[model samples]
Target: MDIDNIAAKAAAKIDAVRDARVNAVKTAAASSVELQEAVQLLAAAEQKYAKDYQAALRADWTESDLRGFGLDAPSKKAGGRPKGARTRQSKPANDAASEKELIGTTSENW
Candidate 1:
């Protein structure tokens, strides 16, 4: 065969390989996006189901029933300071004058 024919055949083969690679990559990227969306949807559904299940349990059972299952009753607040936080009482006006007399004037002296 002529050099021109051989060169044309090789070029065609290279183009075919490149087109196949591009298609494969596009397919994989599309599939990855679809899979990610599905995963997120599944996670949301699982969370909703868990919350609904807890509400159902609360409606059907008493606090003692949960304790029997080795679960503590859900706290009024999830995770924060208790209702009545203990605060230090401020010094009284009379005590403030006496404090300065007992303790030195400056913090360094105290």
Candidate 2:
């Protein structure tokens, strides 16, 4: 009921909230580190699986043989530019005479 008592209560509430926020942030940071490590492990496992699958194919295993074991062949990914995409061609080097012929003025005049 007194001013000092009221101030102390408010300060206690603020401190409690700040402590909760710090704990939450620390928990989330730890979880994020764990998830990043898990993702790297998953990627390495996927790469190994693909390599083994390719080896099986090279060892005279057919798609159907792999499919019988519930494994499907990985889809082929197309590399490079997509269809109908035009690449920019570099301009040819022009001598001073050619430049003058095209623009009616040479670098010397400029």
Candidate 3:
């Protein structure tokens, strides 16, 4: 009922909220580390599977035979630039000359 008692109750509530937020952040960080480890394991397993598949092919196992047994060929992993990667376009050899011509400035002026 008093101002001091009311302030104390509000402070306690705020502290509880802050503690919950901190715990949530800690939980997310722990989950992220676990996910990263799992992803690494998955990539290693995929690489090993691809290698074994290639070996089977080299040992005279035809793709059709593998498919007949329900074992499809390993998919090719994307190897080129990542999505949204910026690439610089090569300028033409006469780019400067074209620019000068567009601005009506001849080589004699320089």
Best by lDDT: 3
Q: Specify the poorest-scoring 10-residue window by lDDT in model 1.
A: 72-81
Cα deviation in Å at residue 50, candidate 3? 0.5
Of 1 and 3, the candidate ahead on TM-score is: 3
The all-Cα superposition gives candidate 1 an RMSD in Å to the true structure of 8.4
**Which tens-of-lDDT digit does each residue in 18-90 have in candidate 2?**
9999999999999999999999997777777777787889899998999999987765322335669888876
Q: Where is the poorest 10-residue window by lDDT in model 2?
A: 74-83
RMSD per candidate (Å) reads: 8.4, 10.0, 11.0
**lDDT tens digits, residue span 80-101, model 1:** 3566889999999899998987
Candidate 1 error regions (>4 Å): 61-110
Cα lDDT of candidate 3 equals 0.83
lDDT of 1 at 4: 98
Considering TM-score, where higher is better, how would the candidates rank from best to worst?
2, 3, 1
What is the lDDT ranking, best to worst? 3, 2, 1
Residue-level lDDT of model 3, residues 1-110, one tens digit each, is 69999999999999999999999999999999999999999887777777777788889999898889887777754233566989889878699678868677655566
Candidate 2 at 15: error in angstroms? Answer: 0.8
